[model samples]
Target: MLTIDNVSLKGINRPRLSNVGLSLDSGKLIGLIGPNGAGKSSLLKAIAGVEAASGKLLWNRQSLSAMNDNERANTLSYMAQDDTPQWDLTIEDIIDIGLLKKRLSRSERQRRVETTSETLNLSEFTGHSIQRLSRGELQRVLLARALVSEPELLLCDEPTNALDIYHQLNVLQLLKKQSEQGRLVMMAIHDIPQAAEYCDELVLLDKGRLVCHGQPFEVLTKENLAATFGIHADWICNKRGVAWQPRPL
Candidate 1:
């Protein structure tokens, strides 16, 4: 289980996060939902142990701040929002960067690299330089990097921002499957309907403060929508999934 207690971070113009607390466990897909500067990224970084902040971030009852770089890397995988490597690294080579260097055996490392590539449908492009791939493809490769690490906790920022409709759905479905297999995943996302459908819980943030958190049906109310985002949306739900269709301008 992961426990967050009164976490806070200082930002450039204002405070990034303030007094945020939550508890999460395995086999759950959690969505961090907020506006552009809602401290979503900072919160993710703090949880991943990349950002220093007040309060406590604990995983399995252990303090995250106490872990070293290597220990944190093995415990959680973080995919930043602007995740693009400038080097002309091939898909497979880029993936190998996420492996736990000292822990995995040579064979185990190779297996993980291959498996992650295939899972993200990048096997055919293994040898292609990341610079040669389109934006959507590169995003997939980045996600592959996070998955290759096989960390117990996966934290991603705006993972669907670069994808087409099909790939967006594909990636979220894959994450759902990962959660079912008894791991934990937390993703920063803008799409409310999708988050409602796939996430076991939704955390709503507004200006560095947590407004509310609960199941999709409870958190995505019209009042919360207007309070968080200055717009109204029509709700849609069916066998396919839940979605909020914003009223046209």
Candidate 2:
């Protein structure tokens, strides 16, 4: 389990995150949902140990702040909201960067890269330069980078921002699969209905505070929707899982 205790970040004029606490478990896909400045990115950065915050981010009772760079890299993988490649490297080259910290042989590294590439359906573009790929394709490559390492905890910030509908669903299903395989997956997602459908738990944030965290049916209520998102929404459960419909207020 990951325990976040009183996690707060000081902003220029206000707190980016304020006394946020959550205990997230493995084997579940959790969605962090909120408006534009809801502190979703800040919280993910804090938990990833990239942004310093005043609180304890403990994984399995171990404090993340105390872990060294290598240890932290091995323990968790972080995918930023927007990552622009500095070098126009090949897809395989970029994916292989995730394995740099591991003590794997050349053959093992190649095998892992091949496996991850196939998983993300990027095998055909393995030799292609990432600079030439579309935004959606680049998103998949970044996600593949975060997944090739196979860390215990995965933190993704808006992993599907630039993807088409098919790729968005594909990525969410892959994240769900990762959680089902005993990895803790927490992603900042913008699609409310997708979050309601795929995530086992939802963390609702508004104005830098955690509004609620629970199952989708429990957290995405009509009241919460109106309060946080400033809209009227409803959810229904049927054969296709939870479906959310939004109505203008």
Candidate 3:
């Protein structure tokens, strides 16, 4: 389990996060939903040890702040919203970087890279430079790097921002599978209906505070849609799937 107690981050004008608290469990896919500047990325960074926030983040009863760099890297993997490679590294090189800290032998490393590449549909682009691929392909490469290690906790920010509709759903399904395998997968995604359908729980944030946290039906109510997203919408859930239909304004 991940325990977040009174986590807060300072900003130049106002606070980025204020006393945000949540107790998340493993084997669940959690969606971090919020509007722009709602501190969704900040909260993920705090939990991933990328941002210096004042709070107690305990991973499975152990404090994340006390863990060293290598220790934290082994425990969790973070995928940023904007991960552009400066150098034109090949897809194989980029994916191999995820296993740099692992003590796996040569054959094991190759096995991991091959498996991850195939899973993300990147096997054909092994030797291709990242600069030559499309935005969506690059996004998959970044996701492959995050998944190659198979960390216990995965934190991703806007992971599907650059993907097509098909790839977006495919990746979300993959994330759901990751959680089903006993890993905690938390992602900041903009697709409300998809998040509602796939995620086991949703953590809603607004104005740097946690508005609500629960199942999709509980958190994505009419009031929350209006207050957080400034819209009037009706949430529909049935055998087909989940959808938030926006009413005519």
Tens digits of lDDT, candidate 1, 151-225: 889999988988999989989999988888888999999988889888999999999999988888888888888
Model 1 regions more than 4 Å off:
none
TM-score of each predicted structure versus truth: 0.95, 0.97, 0.97
lDDT of 3: 0.92
TM-score of 1: 0.95
Local error of candidate 2 at residue 134 (angstroms) = 0.5
List clashing residue pairs in candidate 1.
Answer: none
**Candidate-wise lDDT, in order:** 0.89, 0.93, 0.92
Tens digits of per-residue lDDT, candidate 3, 178-218, equal 99999999999888999899999999999899999999889
RMSD of each: 1.5, 1.0, 1.1
lDDT score for residue 54 of model 3: 99
